[model samples]
Target: MTFGGTVLPEWKQRDTRPGAHPLRQSGHGQRFGGPCVKGLWRRAVVVGLALTVAACGRGGVDAKRIAAADGAEWLTYGRTYDEQRFSPLAQVNKDTVGKLGVAWWAEFDTDRGQEATPLVADGVLYTTTAWSKVYAFDARTGKQLWKYDPKVPGEAGFNACCDVVNRGVALWKGRLYVGTIDGRLIALDARTGAVAWDVQTTDRTKPYTITGAPRVVKGKVLIGNGGAEYGVRGYVSAYDADSGKLAWRFYTTPNPKGAPDGAASDRVFRDKASATWSDGVWKESGGGGTVWDAITYDPKLDLVFIGVGNGAPWNHKLRSGGKGDNLFLSSIVALRPETGEYVWHYQTTPGESWDYTATQHIMLADLNIGGVERRVVMQAPKNGFFYVLDARTGALISADKYVPVDWAERIDLSTGRPVEAPSARYRDGGISQQASSPLGGHNWQPMAFSPREGLVYVPAMRNRGFYADALGFKFIPGAWNTGLTRAQAGPNTPSPKPATPPLATGELIAWDPVARKARWTLALPAAWTSGVLATEGGLVFHAAGNAFTAYDANDGKALWSYDAGANVIAPATTYAIDGEQYVALMVGVGGAPMGGDQPRRPGRLLVFKLGGTVKPPPYPAAVAMPPLDLAAATPSKGDADRGAALFGQFCGACHRIGGLLPVLPRSPAILDGEGFKAIVLDGALKANGMAPFRRYFDEAGAEDIRAFLLWQAKQPAPAPKPGGASHG
Candidate 1:
């Protein structure tokens, strides 16, 4: 069962080894020197860069006038660059943000999973963790100034279909750039984290991981890869921010011997659309369109937007080996941050079979709406709506349902389509359901937008999930639920759940893009997936589960909170160094499939500010766990009648072996025995993509799978008997 790239060689935490190599440039891609040849090769320009320097577009700067509006120093990744996580640094507004505090903190000795976003400048902070490593800290006393790793390739965490985590870093000139869950693109040296150039942005043998964050602009850097669920092919490159090279790519799907924006009127189905997916399911379904997270960057429209993801075995009738509309997948696109071309696209789920993904957060602004300043580009997309568009012609100036959608009962706006909801698709034994499921009522986080509280906060999550087929599934190169086939366990299973008068939790809302509505909406004890920043006095900042808060962006009330004990993962940034204003976040409670009960492994790295005398710093230690072979470990069970006939011949559409099946198991990190012996002997937990039991167990069939998961967590939990019921 350890399927994806297998590597639990005792949780191999760190062994990087590649340091000081620098000094290249000679015969750059040579032709005169033999061994390489591009356009007859060429190389000569040396050194050059410095002019009080400033070139690289894409919302690149303007932290409200170059890091000033209250400055505490949070360089990028939505802090600015039109990513608009907003932050005009209001020295702890909402009336002294309830005396804010905790001034320091920075514990990430690495249990692997932080999904970064720290990057302060001058006072020094930078982020990036879980498999991509990268640190740097010291932003006002958190200390520990250097870390870097890059070791990626313990089979690239089985090309992470999700969660080997990383999302942070990117500075420019003095250097930093990141991208490398094994797709490479390094750089570093922003005053000594070392390794100046690494390259190789894609082709992790075609698996690609790069968990987001890497924008740099002007002199290039960009990035964008994450196997839209282990089925690759979803470009966006652009390098050379100073010797990394490669320069341009684009390609969000379309090319079958044509694509410069293919068209039949909006890229009309583009060349046989993955030839309807059956035979060899496109090299084991390796074409899902993975641009991982938001990439923003408008520098007054030098473009570079990007979002696109989803379009793999999320059953678009089995990867379009049928249906159609597969065009630039869950799209948004835009491009041209210096030749990555493509320039435009909107799509947002066109032949998309429910994993609906516009990769989440994007922001960018200008607004004034009916008064007409225009330029916008908001986004909430996990298909539950909240759009806004018109960022210079992607059109659709409005879209609603900030949450709980029963699969689009309204979104027609003269013809943007959506009417949807016939129980939301997937036939056969009937089980459909749908309403922002696919763990998305907003996926990937980051969603602010304040210009002194005009609104738009959102952290969202109304939750719902159901759908099937993988008929014979297939594609298994580098695995992680690859290609498919794994849905058994059926029996008395009932579990339909989530419908308690529709308040299934998670919020932060806000809205008001020039009076489009909802300016307030609190709720939150769990389910936020991080994001929210706003500032300039009224306040907003955010973080849940392990606490850290601040609100009142004009009445959601509650200004200031603390705790930082767990959960609250990522997105919460502010800045303003000299004149004071620091906020910073990126805390991870677990590799999120959802985070509520907290504590999974060490994981911490908070950073607040607003006086009462700072403090924090001194936690970083818990990263030293490797010695459990216990001479060939032990924990087995091998046959609940052959694991219920191999989970009903192959895992019944998205897991549910619970009181013995009905399904819809939202990754409780695979319910235990050390997460089932690291999902059967660890290929780094199938390279972070899960679903790996080393191709069906074998160390005594994973000790009879720890006695069938201690006879399935000691059974129980399945009572609630009532009308719509069957009591498995």
Candidate 2:
């Protein structure tokens, strides 16, 4: 039989034929056409066949298909190249949303954060879990089809600045590409969950990791790494989809040694970026500009844009002797996807000392500006500013503060830089409090754009940080490289006694980009809320605290909500199966800022549709920590200062004075040396997601930690300040 000019061998004839067509044969088949065709004919036929296969393999997510997604499927990370994350599906509209309930829920093994946005195509749902694990399920029924675990090393968890979380995976050509936390990019056979090819994208020895999802453009899988806090240079690399060979790499920062690294970024760095640096100490610590998140591809313009991270040793004074714009540190750069050539860049935070990363979310759209329709790229970066730029020419169209900010009064449209406040730099050895902490006005939580409403939905944060220089800055081998001390940044300190505290708050703001004003704002109980998803149903979905709530997209009126029983930090996605629309999101909260004191429950993927009848499990009750009697107990007699250092190194990552996990100072077990030894050395809490530190701590070391906890328990808590820093 002939199908689309390609011969399909008959079953009976295949057994009798001596040399059957390679496509019909078993065991490692040859390229589509058989050896029967030769020379020019073979080449032409193969090219044609390849194009056909490519079109089919795109599986409802090709450029044309995504542009016209029509709400039946979610093909790409943002549902389209524009990354608007808005769905046209209205099956569960405002009137019917009140009837929405859980359609199905799938629990994951790891309890770490689940920050992925699932991709639905051809009735299959694809998502990633903690530690870069991928899973596929039936979109309608929620039956697990297959699961793939890259088995990333347990120790690699330390390299991740946040918890061991993976944002998502990319689907292309019948394959799913995922970047493991240990810096490896693996492509899997989408149907069988089998490994297709694996390539290490970063140096295993360095503190580099890949928590962000991969994006595919022009038959190339592009991936970037994280670890700016751990002191590593950052770059984004593209690999051939079929062969897993390196195609090109674009480094975000320049070589520290005043020499070219012979990379795609060399020419641009030397010509445009080198002058922005003062050299010296920055060369030792690779200038941190990790492109951990936010890669968008514009097929119409044929350009790929990446949001670059903050600088290493966050204090610009320490990192670069308090000078230079530090080109590309906090910027959005456009590049040629095929050859990785530089196009143009707009630095969001020049001399980014406050950890104001430009790597938040990038959305593309055509908006009427000054009565003229302009192609624009929009972003609300960490510095608390909403910016609109010419997507084609990289020109600043307009920018305004989307949230409260003191670091800079406003963005200067003429120079494309911020008009810094007098005390914003904090270079005189005095503490400077600034709005929009290191966590940013927005973090990795994605924002959504609605062309129908002409508004951008932002998960806006109101937070601040106190920045003070660490007098004698020293780089730790594999620890956080911020030149500011932990306590000075304001939240990662140990407190023994209780104190009244000012709270940080978050809000969902619908802002008109052209007008630079918010249409409406819905205040959340807590700061650091989840991302937003707007639907044609006249409803917007967002996860705050323990509920997934739907609000009227235009008026911000509460429409409906479901208790997810777990804190959610990932964005919600919508798709349709068999003419029915379903809204899906991952539920788990364990990132840096939301870690301590926040609930630590099992991760779950919850799906909902109108009139669905599945009920979610009840939320776990808060665990009350037992009272401590450290004064009545025998002292461990260890060096309290040494113990304090150890606690900061080991326990500070997850534990806080009043967080989701038990507060160390108030825990009775830590007050008792033997009890501490049992939990830390005997792995008593290993089953509950705590790692056994037996390999790193001995009996004496455990007692030292106990001593520190005892000392901390006796001290008075510092006065809580509003808008204090909280890592995300």
Model number with the top TM-score:
2
Enumerate residue pairs that collide in model 2. 593-727, 596-659, 596-660, 597-659, 597-660, 598-660
Determine which window of 10 residues in candidate 2 has minimal summed lDDT: 22-31
User: For residues 24-96, could you state the per-residue lDDT of candidate 2 as single tens digits?
Assistant: 2222222223222222232232224334433453553455555545456787899888899988666576767
Tell me the lDDT of candidate 1.
Answer: 0.61
What residue runs in model 2 are displaced by over 4 Å at the alpha carbon? 1-61, 488-503, 590-600, 629-634, 642-651, 658-663, 666-706, 716-728
Off by over 4 Å in 1: 1-85, 90-313, 318-321, 324-347, 353-356, 362-372, 375-377, 380-388, 391-443, 447-568, 573-586, 591-607, 610-613, 630-728
Question: How does each model score on lDDT?
Answer: 0.61, 0.78
- C-alpha RMSD (angstroms) for model 1: 24.5
The window of 10 residues in a row where model 1 has the poorest summed lDDT is 44-53
Model 2 has an lDDT value of 0.78
RMSD of 2: 10.4
TM-score of each: 0.30, 0.86
